[model samples]
Target: MGNRTAVIVACALVGLTVSTPAFADSPAPSTYGRASYLLDESTGKAMISKRADKRVPIASLTKIMTAYVVLGQAKLTDKVRITAKDVRYAERGGATTADLRPGDRLTVKELLYGLMLPSGADAAHALARTYGPGVDGFTAKMNATAKAMGLSNTSYVNADGLPARGGDGYSTARDQARLAAAALRNPTFRSVTSTKSRTVASTADHRAYSWTNTNRMLDAPGSLGVKTGYTRAAGFNLAFAADRKGRRLVGVILGETDSSRRFDTARSLLKWAAKHPVEGNG
Candidate 1:
């Protein structure tokens, strides 16, 4: 086996303790869909891979990309009006909402909190309507940014990631991982996702509303920030990252059974990755 793989196996056996154990020749869980990958931030190497290049529906995890697009185009202090067009009629009933009303005024920063913390589809639409010229216009910008970032397999349709009539919103595990890494580069993006609770002050028509992050893993001590997504078609999708002893790891698991299981898998994967310290800055 390769040295890094051998190290990971040894660490897995001994529990990442000081005394490494003999490498085990066992298979890891193969429970995932279209694509999944674990990235070693220190060496910029993908330690595990499965269909990393295949584009698939990513659900609300697409909001992270939405945040990236909006943060670049608008300032936090800017005020946005939540229009009717921004809210999606939830025929299937998706939770994690800002519950924005028409003409309610809020700062771009708070809207970001709404988007990242609650996975607010309304907030996503608000940003797109304001800065994207329209949804299609904003999607164009998203694709352009993806190309710039060398994400050849990524594409976005609706800003809220509800999935279009045909196959529209799509991304690969590798693409999502790269996007998460890039999003972390922006201090604003990192700030919003890492925070557990956000309280937006009352607007003229509404009282203060507190939104909690959807990613349960953030409740853990070392987790920095990440996004989660789900749909009947997409199953359970999650993008997760954490820091321990100054080392960071990002992982994605697509198509799981339940919400808690997805989060648990994320925590487990992150813990495992944390155990194997990569070369250099790890």
Candidate 2:
């Protein structure tokens, strides 16, 4: 096995034996997803992992990377005019939308709220077009960023995580945990994902809009905004982060057949990890 794969296996094995006094009587969290991973964000230790390296379609979780790339290149105040094509792309795909209107102009910051909160394919297209100059160019940046971040098992074919004609975008639980760690470090990215709701007042340039986050975990204590995604092919997917007593954890659940179960599993894992705090490298 490759050195990296070997290390992951070792960590997964270690995670299996970890337990603490706080949850001595509690059973370990049971995950219903096909793949799941949890990490101690401070030390990069694997806390709980199951088939973490298995690659699968990621659905709207693709938007996390989309936001990451856009934050790297665009100023929050920069304006992008919504195009009919952008609106049409989301509608034709029967994808979620931010309800952005064509001919209306909104800032990059506003669009991000639309993108992350509603898992808006329309908002993703607008940002991709503005920053990438086109969908192809933007997705190229997404793939390049993934490689640079050392996410070997992840690939992106589109900005919004929608399935491409050839194939859908794919990623493993472990790679996604790492990606969430990197993304949560960015203040703008963190703020956008954590927001439960955002309202943009109407102006002459654009219509008013309000977006509610799709991530249900946001309401939970210590929950930090990350991202959530779903598609017929991808199943219910979630990349999540939480903080407890200054210790932070990041996790990903992919290929969950049940929507509510994904969040339940995440909460269970987070609560379990809080009790079994990582010491040193865990």
Error (Å) of candidate 1 at residue 39 is 1.2
Instruction: Score candidate 2 by TM-score against the native.
Output: 0.90
Best candidate (score: TM-score): 2
Q: lDDT tens digits, residues 43-155, model 2?
A: 77887777888999999999999999999989999999999999999999999999988888889999999999999999999999988989999999999999999999999
Ten-residue region with minimum lDDT total, candidate 2 = 15-24
Q: Each model's C-alpha lDDT?
A: 0.76, 0.86
Name every residue pair that clashes in candidate 1. Answer: none
lDDT of 2: 0.86
Q: Give TM-scores for every candidate, taking all chains together and pairing residue i with residue i.
A: 0.86, 0.90
lDDT of 1 by residue, 1-282 (tens): 776577566544532221222224333333345567777665676655667777788899889888998989888999998877666532234645678777788899999998888888888888888888887899889889999999998888878778678675888888898889878878888888899998888576557878998888887667867898988878889898877667667778776667688777677667665666555421
